[model samples]
Target: MEQGLALGMGLDVGRREEEEAASADEEDGEVRRSVEPAVPLKLLPLLPVPRQPSPPLLRFPSSTATRNLDASTRGIDTNRAPSTEEAEEASSSSPNRAVSSFRTGFSAQRGSAERGGVAERASSILSDEEENGLAKKKLRLSKEQSAFLEESFKEHKTLNPRQKLALAKQLNLRPRQVEVWFQNRRARTKLKQTEVDCEYLKRCCRTLTEENRCLQKEVAELRALKSTHPFYMHLPATTLSMCPSCERVASTPATAAADHRPSSFAALFSKPTPAAPRQPPDNFRPQPPAATGHSCT
Candidate 1:
């Protein structure tokens, strides 16, 4: 409140003095007051802030930027592409995979299959020899090879010791392999032969047994027929003369003797008696009834 009053009074007094001085032409008692102060002033220093160096500019080289730009322009696929198995192998392999190497591998495997097949086909010893003809040339036994072959051939019945040696020497294979091969071949042949023999025996047994059973049944039927008919047993021995074609028994020797024309005489026998001709007595006739019936019965 006091400060406000003092400021107001100072302002009023300055204003009144200015008004009185403007109208004081001959007045000796008029006083003038100034709104400006005439006191000694103290100076306060303004502080200056210390200057600091700016941070260093970070920048990439033009080549690096250009590389990134070019990479982007090419595409994400080029930058992030996955490598193939072949490519990885090529990179990792020491000597590298040559075209010739693949061919060699294929040929080696094919040769092995062919060799195994040829060695196993054993219908006859000769069959094996024939199949192995090329193999023999290919693996002819050197002295060392012969030793190996001999070692292997011991296990096989089909392969001669000489053949085994020849094969071993020519093949540049170990005697053990030759032995194993021959052993396997022999085993296979034996198994097949045994199977065939078993089948043959089974069939033979079946046929024989069937025939035997049939004979037994026939014997039983004959016994039954004899028991059923008393007339069949009472038949005369002459009546037992049998016709070869139909096996019908004849009733009497006279009829049987008359029927005894040879097969070549069938044409005459088959013809009927001629009406115009009178037949002469035949030279052939039965001896005593007992003798005539002997051969016929």
Candidate 2:
């Protein structure tokens, strides 16, 4: 009987443990259901996740890669001999290559021609510049040079070859330039002298004209005086007398000297004559005239 009671108690304890395990399972299912999302997880759309940046890589060229790069660069040498395969390829395309080479040579020739033309133009421009420089040098002289030349000209109007050479050296000028300056200076001096002489001749002509006009007027006055005074023109010849002191001929008016001349003549006639001899002469007289022998008796 004790054995039966123990089995019944063991069966009741196993039942209680089974019920507690089932209740715990039901509470866990309820908690899981409440924590779940409203929408099903399988029905939601997915998004891509952002990845983190990776570290930079530092890669170096291997020896074989560097050799390949060098070979590729050196394969383009223009003077290098072609390989057998390349020669064959070039032969196959020889006509095209020939056309391209001809075009290149023609373009090179055209470029050279253009360069030659440019050089020629540059040479012409340089020549023009040189000509302009020479012209400027010839045309323009400084004040000091001009003054020196002027002083030399004052000292000598004309220059011999030796003198011109000396002056050119002293003034730092060419002999031709000095000679030309002297020639122009002499021309100017001669022209100035000619002008002065012309002015003097004009003054002399004016003075002579005035003198001639005055002489003509005096001659006209003398002619009029002679024509108006007929008595002065026709004075008697006897009225002319000579002065003993001055020995010059003088003339008196005939009417005024006539009465004086007759008075002087009468005074000359009235002058006394000498008286006759007296009785002394009768006493002194001796005899009558003596007769000749042949007188008639």
Candidate 3:
């Protein structure tokens, strides 16, 4: 009986513990339900559904529409209006006709543009030639005009604008023409002066060259004489003298007398013979001798 009582107490304790755990779990669930928000089913937005792709619709033209399209295409492809038979043929060979027609059209357009450019260029060139021909026309001056211009140029090499205008009026020529004539005259004068100066310089150069050549030849001849006759170069130079009273010819340093001197030492003491007197010319007459203080015996 005591054992049964103990087992019944233990069972009651276990049941009370289980009851406490269940109460705690219920409180937690209540707190959770109070904290969370509640939404109505009708207030929520619905998700969109993805659409599927549909196949494309194709509509083929009728036979009449096809014929009409071919006829229009052929008309555009050809330059002239196409007949019914040609249109049919073009339609039969549509691809080739289209290619050939495109090439021909492009070439024709290019040719036309090129021709227009060439024509424009030719016209411009012709206009330019006409303008240049008018601008560059040559005028001939009469003898009076030339003579007057020459006289004016002789007075003054250059002309003032007023002078140029006056000259042009007097000569019945344009001022530009007058100015050109003066310019040409000055150029011709300068050219002629330059030619004269050039000729003078050439003559001077030739003269100097000839002089130099002659001097060189003289130097060469002198050098040859020295080389050939070295003794003549070494010989002492001698000059001739005349005594006024006796009119005798005397050689200064006497080259011939020295040559005739003896080689022996004894000849140094020999008395030298005097040279003969020079003869007077046949046309000359001797004057009488002047008297001296002492008379000759």
Candidate 4:
């Protein structure tokens, strides 16, 4: 019995060890499965880069189109404007990039170039007129375009970079052209304000001149009246002179002479007239009183 029990116990212990080993192997397999995805991500830096999309081609005016447009309106000196659609399309396709590329190329040439570089530079960047061998075409904006720009000017007096770009795009105009238009609009506004101020000042000056003329006429009339009539002159500071024997005062020699009025100084220097003797009453009866007084005495 002891021997059989010992063998059975050893078999059970061996089965438990085999089961633990199998579980450990399963856990390791799961850990490896979780780590496999990360391995590919770490190798991504070593992989070759994919090709990039090609840049859009810059559109320029065709020589034939320019020639046909010029020929159709020759000798008139009328503005032959370019199509808004063509300008829009050309400007939309990485225009800034093109300019940057051109500038880089120019800088590269400026660093290392032979003599007579002027001719070589001119030959490199072909202008629209030079490419077509035609006269430079000037674009006259349509009436609608002018009106739209004017309306925009009324809203705001100035524009920033983004505003300028947006306006140029909307109007199918070059950014520089929009900037110049705004400058000219501001100038026109200033000129109009100056004219209004000048006109107002002119009116004010005219009114002042008329008032001065009226005042001068009044002054002249006053002066003429003063000169014509001596009586209208300022009076003397002395008090009025009156005769001692009369109630009336004399203002002038002519008034005194006409009225036979004696002046206060003249009356003081004149001699007094002699007085006559007194006479008795006509109905006198004093003879009895006087006889009584003398007989009694």
Candidate 5:
């Protein structure tokens, strides 16, 4: 086991030396690309010795040096100067061909950033326009506008599309606004007419009710009279027996006076006696006997 450990250790040492030499060769080749010579680098750790045993080959940043090298390779602008350690790492990692690769990556990142900025600006502008359209604006009509609309409504209750457009332009208002005003005006007129009709119907109903009540009262009175005097309808039909001369005198007068004469039923209730017979006139002559009944006595 001890021999194997020694052999592994020797192998590890040889491998580490070969790696360092290869890295150094790469650094030298890269250093010749730029006009300024590259700074020599140290592979020592930038930390104080610890009291306890630490892990092997631990790496850490050594101030602004690493930051400068990262900024340069990634096409970022920085004011800090690079350290010797970071310069050596940059040279080792980057060869002559690697410069073009680093520049292309940086350009691709910059193009993506610019495209994102333009997209954001366009979206913000569209949002602002949408909000403006969605928000409604309140309009207050002037006195002149109100008067003109009222006059137009009196002339015509409704308007065609052409008339609406012309009116909108004349009044500096939207066609839809004009249409709504006319609708409201017509509705008010209809409501007023409906109220008048209702009042007239109410009056007619009241008059009919009064007339019906009067007719009902008259019918009730007639029914009561019939119930009270049942025998009045069944009286006997008799003539008012009078002398011939008096009947002739009564018939010569007007109809009203004739109707005033007492009927049979009135006479029965009064119980009047028969009238006396009338005497003949004095100018009458007696006829001679046709046969000899007593020999002309």
Candidate 6:
């Protein structure tokens, strides 16, 4: 185990040294590239509420239906078994027929944030039908009924709480169904926006990745070209032999020459001086030339 760790440390050191050398050799002209922050995938677009239409004139049973039911329809007594025909009759009234209108504590357009709070709270107060079993209690309205309810929802005057309740009661729907439909519609809108954002992020990622790959390939090609070029590879032997200033193969020749110490360098101190010549002994005398300084053709 100790041997393995030592081997690993050595390899790590070697790799670090090589990396440092490579980095040192790189030109200082290269600037660091900055990466941009990642973009979030789809975010829901915030759609403002449609402008409130002019308040509709309230419809009441002038004086005659007063005998049968109150103008506000506040006369509903839930204890009395609700008959189907009565429910139908209540619903069939002109949706525009004035039921007594009630004003809200806040304005819809001016207090949208407060309205959002109310909406979230309303969601928290949902009935069991809303939680997991929207299917079993399906309140599928008839094509005609759905068209009529859809039209009522578009009416600016009919957007108030009392109007919506009256309309739901007439349509023989629980107020919850009407509320759920709008909530679902809003959710669907937001989900689509999220999907759009996700797609945009994916496309951006692909583009950046492609660009990075191209840059890496370009860098590799440049390094390869630099490796083979004679400019850095094949300097003359004479140039290799000595620095131009101090006649040495090391360090900055220009700086050495500028400092004016090139001639009296280490070379002078290391070399021996040629002072006097010595004669050979008679025993080791040179033989006479076979022919005097003449060459045979």
What overall lDDT goes with each candidate model? 0.35, 0.38, 0.40, 0.39, 0.39, 0.35
In TM-score terms, candidate 4 sits at: 0.34
Between candidates 1 and 3, the one scoring higher on TM-score is 3
* Candidate 5 lDDT by residue in tens digits, 175-258: 555766778889999999999888777765664555345446545643564477565333354334432322211111222332
lDDT of 4 by residue, 1-297 (tens): 322222222222222222233333422233222111100111112111112232221121365334323323444211222132222222322224122232434544443333434434322223443223232223356566678789878776775434555677787666545766898899999999999888777765664555446446545654675577556435444245533222224233323332232222233213222332322332131233212111111
lDDT of 3 by residue, 1-297 (tens): 222222222222222222233333421233222111111112111111111121221122364334334333544321122232222222222233322232434444444434434324322211222222222224356667788899988887876544655676676565556777888999999999999888777765664555446446545654675587666445576565544333434343345543442222112212332443444532122222221111111
Q: How many pairs collide in each candidate, listed in order?
A: 8, 0, 0, 0, 0, 9
Each prediction's TM-score versus the true structure: 0.29, 0.33, 0.35, 0.34, 0.33, 0.28
Give a tens-digit lDDT track for model 6, residues 157-267: 123333434555666564445555555655676799999888777765664555446446545644564476535323333122332322224322232222332222323
Error of 1 at 213 (Å): 2.0
Error of 1 at 216 (Å): 1.9
Worst 10 residues of 2 by lDDT: 288-297
Residue 17 in model 1: lDDT: 27
- Stretches off by above 4 angstroms in model 6 are 1-136, 144-163, 166-172, 230-297
The 10 consecutive residues of candidate 1 with the worst lDDT sum are 41-50
Q: Candidate 5: minimum summed lDDT over ten consecutive residues — where?
A: 288-297
* Candidate 2 vs candidate 5, lDDT winner: 5
Per-residue lDDT tens digits for candidate 1, residues 42-116, read 211111111122222113246544433433454422122122211222222213322213243444444643453
For model 5, which pairs clash?
none
Query: Which of 1 and 5 is ahead in lDDT?
Result: 5
lDDT of 2 by residue, 1-297 (tens): 222222222222222222233333422233222211111122111111112122221121364334334333544322123332222222222233221222434444444434334324322111222222221122344566678888877765665444554566676554545666777888898999999888777765664555446446545644564577545446564465432222223343446433343222212212222332222323212211111111011
lDDT of 6 at 56: 29
Greater-lDDT candidate between 1 and 3 = 3
